[model samples]
Target: MRSAAMRDEPRVTDAEARRIAFAAFVGTALEWYDYFLYGTAASIVFNRLYFVSGDPVVATLAAFASFAVGFVARPIGAVIFGHVGDRRGRRASLIITVTMIGVVTALIGLLPDFAAIGVAAPILLTLLRVFQGIAVGGEWGGAVTLAVEHAPPERRGRYAALPQVGSPIGTLLSSGAFALVSLLPADAFDSWGWRLPFLAAIPLLFVALYLRRRIEESPLFTELLQQQERSSSPVVEVLRRSFGRVLVGLSASLLGVGGFYLLTTFAISYGTETLHLPRSLMLGATLVAAVVEIAILLAFGRLAERWGPGNVCVVGGVASALVAFPVFWLIDTKNPALVVLAITAGVACLSVPYAVAGSLLTELFPPQLRYSGVSIAFNLGGVVSGFVPFAATAVLAASGKQSWSVALLLVGLSVLTALGGAIGERLRIEDDVSAA
Candidate 1:
């Protein structure tokens, strides 16, 4: 009953699995570093440097709006790179995506400020952000797919979670870089210190490409190629055959992607502007939170082996919802210790679902279209997540700076994540039955 192509494919040894997983981790870390760097800058630097306005609030909103432009480009990136990943190979798509992000990010560092170039500065910045968004849109899905597909079925969850680790690592590195630079005097920081983090992306990119080039193509994808089973139009095929799965994956991904922005980006702005906390305090909180999330992700990856990734997601969602208000309360207190504790707890709770999202999403569609399916769903969720900071900022302003309204927003996102997990589990069961 087994096809020759499937049988002929080499089994993934534990060593090979680890190798691929490490490569995925490195690649994704680079991707997220570029992404999170922009986010950190948008909150603290870009509003002043690029989107200068008379009113601080107006300038911040404008900067965040430019940040949201990348999210809009994400779905487009998903479709384009997803097609390449699905039709060509995951390796090729990743190389292209990583290279694109590295170049664009470095360019941003060298870009002229608003004072130097007037409107052209912000316009170019937004364009670069769009390219960054597109590159990232493709990066995660391919990285996760390559890692998961290269592992044995029993180890898929652990390997899949490896790529997810890159997120917190990215957060850690980006936050740390910004934190270091934030130590500069105001005039110096506003002038040139902020560009260091973005410029650092160039070296990091080379390291990522080296690791990625060393890894082999996914065996599952190789099998597809050998069988001549690759879809000519993976995007169209996925949309037609598994549109519902895409919706489910989008919901499952909300808290990890969207809630992350709520907790970090928006919270950073909230801490600084409303509570009058120092920039160092907010960045420091994020650094601590990222460390906590790394541990939580590793632990949960193992837990997913026994409890199932879906179940873990459901639990994480509920826990995040319960802690949403508490997180805000702790931040509102303005005590540095409590603020760090609050962000750490929030990131830890939400990370439970995020840790295993890669494996869960990969299972949502067949290998033939896995790239497109995962990319579309995940990036579509990103599309919304990208705007979360802007929306939260707007909501907070409109509600007279009430933290409770923002908490309510987090609660709603958490609930949707839970619902998606439940639905995904049921669908997996149905799929198993059909296979049996």
Candidate 2:
């Protein structure tokens, strides 16, 4: 079935490349579905499930603290998995990371109630989250980089965007599950039904793995391997040489992704409690935003191709900064239509930089150190943003200023993200293929 030109084309056939991209999409989707599902649960379910505290604010902060633990663990996971990925190959790294995520998530579903385990339950839950963070920490950089490196230069934006597309796909699936489950009685759902969403991810991971196995090492990575040009210490080499890029990349992702987790992840709570909106209404807002997020992500990739990712990000950040305050004010209005419009607008503006994050970091380093650099930025960004919800809550509690606080915070971060993107554009070149 091979074409004459394909005889010397690459390690993978054209059909195989498509197969790999699909696999990467599916795997990334399943991982984020599980990952973000926990965030959704932490925002809604964890306060009741883990903490018996009568105080809503205390419980909310505790749930967020637990959520933050997952992001904290991601950097460590990146370090361990980054080494394996660079020293080994993208294929082996994914196999291990996916396996870990699949097992931990399913087990999270099976975990005993706080009442049954007493103090041990939340402690155990935090530990499991740590592992989940670690698994995904290593998984993303490898997944996106593999797809991007294997793709042709002209198609790189769309190809890289393929795995990036998985974020919204995953968000859609996970958020949809929570939406469906919300239809159940609150007591019943809290007691047992919430586990179903987490348990649901196992089958998806298996399918992702099968598809991913068909992909070979990237041609660029293969050339590096064949030449034996890998770094003596990839982590060190990346740190010593690429540290500035990593810092910039990490800072860029922090505002958008962190802002996202705060808005989508923590805002779920904000809408329900602080704003006193319905769970379905807030989730509906997230679903709307997610749809727009997908559209924005897809089109923006083409836009980035035409205008460069930096300019696209600048436009996005400016939009986020300018509109954030009014958007938050509208959401707190308790007017359903207005709230929906605000949510959609807020996330769409934020999606600009986030949509391009994987590609930005992926293109920053050489093949061997790419994994290290990307993983560091990704994990660190999560850590920074992961704490945003808790910090937002505490700040709001102290200042009694939920609306303006969130708006100004998100807008400020967006401006910072745009600044980072501008810096990256000026300083770095797109990684070109080296002579084999």
Candidate 3:
């Protein structure tokens, strides 16, 4: 065993904490931007280009199926990259994930559509989507672990929330880009404008890699390395010893992941295809919601400081459940202002649970199994929730385009989030009582 003296590295300075947090924020934002841009394209562009069919709805379904394929690859990434993160270092794993995501996203820009490559176009696109999923599957746990581990103990909530900010930041950029490209004459936008956003990943890749390289490994991970206490099989260890924790973590994430995709991805399609709303209106509404969510997330981070993450998230989760039907009601009105309000309300409800999820998950697992444990739970939830768009789309189609069916699904997920969070809290209390 390493000497206690050797393990006692100085705590990270505030300046260094900010630097680490900023790098995490930037890298995660770019990854989400790349990942979410695909969802945006799926709703508006890919269905028309990659999957040509006589029926537009059938073509759109095919595209969503392809979109969901990415989720299937996430667990694979969690195992591969989680091992590296658990044994090697957080910085190394992050560098690899960011690079993989960036390259794949840029490559997507070069892919030929159906006209050029026939059936191969979508097949290739699905392959790239798998890579994207793997890259991101490995990303969230590493980012959260890095931020939380480097932070002062009392400030972990706020620090961990920094990475969560990346989601909305990414959404804002993705929606803004799509909205801009959407301005082109429909033919021009369809032909080439959609490619611009995907191609933009090239420069972002360099920036994220450059910033990530400048940061040190997590101090906690470095300590584990010095002690030579790394688990031989971190993922297996997590499953064998702490699977309940894993389930709780996954449960906590359902609403944020599921509800988020529904609002941003499926809502875009619903607005355009079913409601007969303009494409720009849907994109613009999404952009506004993204902007509002950023502030709400930051506020909740501060709220977590006083109220605790569990309490704040529980309240947020329940409130989200209550408002689910009303949110869809607003969207059904078809007024631009009401539509924006609907999306904004749905996303805002998500901010509370999302803000605390990083710190909460980090706390649930010990440092040795932290990377593997969080990665499995987070990515597993991602895989399950990844189908939200596809599932919501199918439900809408089956209901003959009734918005109520989708709303009910959203409410059900919110209830699950509340129950999952409560279970986690109960488990934590039981653990504390046992220790006492």
lDDT of each: 0.91, 0.80, 0.87
Instruction: Give candidate 1's TM-score.
Output: 0.97
- For model 3, how does the per-residue alpha-carbon lDDT over 1-436 read when each residue is reduced to its tens digit? 1223223433787777878988999999999999999999999999999989999899889988888888878888888889999989889999999999999999998898999999999999999999999999899999999998888766877888899999999998899999998889988997888999999999999999999999889988888888787889999988898898888888888888888999989999999988989999999988888888888888888787777676777887898988888999999999899999999999899777888888777767777778888888888888888899999989999999888899999888888777777776666555445544
Say what the RMSD of model 2 is: 4.2
Candidate 2 ranges beyond 4 A from true positions: 1-18, 429-436
Among residues 3 or more apart in sequence or in different chains, the pairs in candidate 2 whose N, CA or C atoms overlap within 3 Å are none
lDDT digits (tens) for residues 353-392 of candidate 1: 9998998898888888889999999999998888999999
- Using lDDT as the measure, the top candidate is 1
Between 2 and 3, whose TM-score is larger? 3
lDDT of model 1, residue 153: 75
Best by TM-score: 1
Write candidate 2's Cα lDDT for 165-205 as tens digits.
Answer: 78888889999999999999988898888989999878877
Model 3 steric clash pairs: none
Question: How high a TM-score does candidate 3 get?
Answer: 0.96
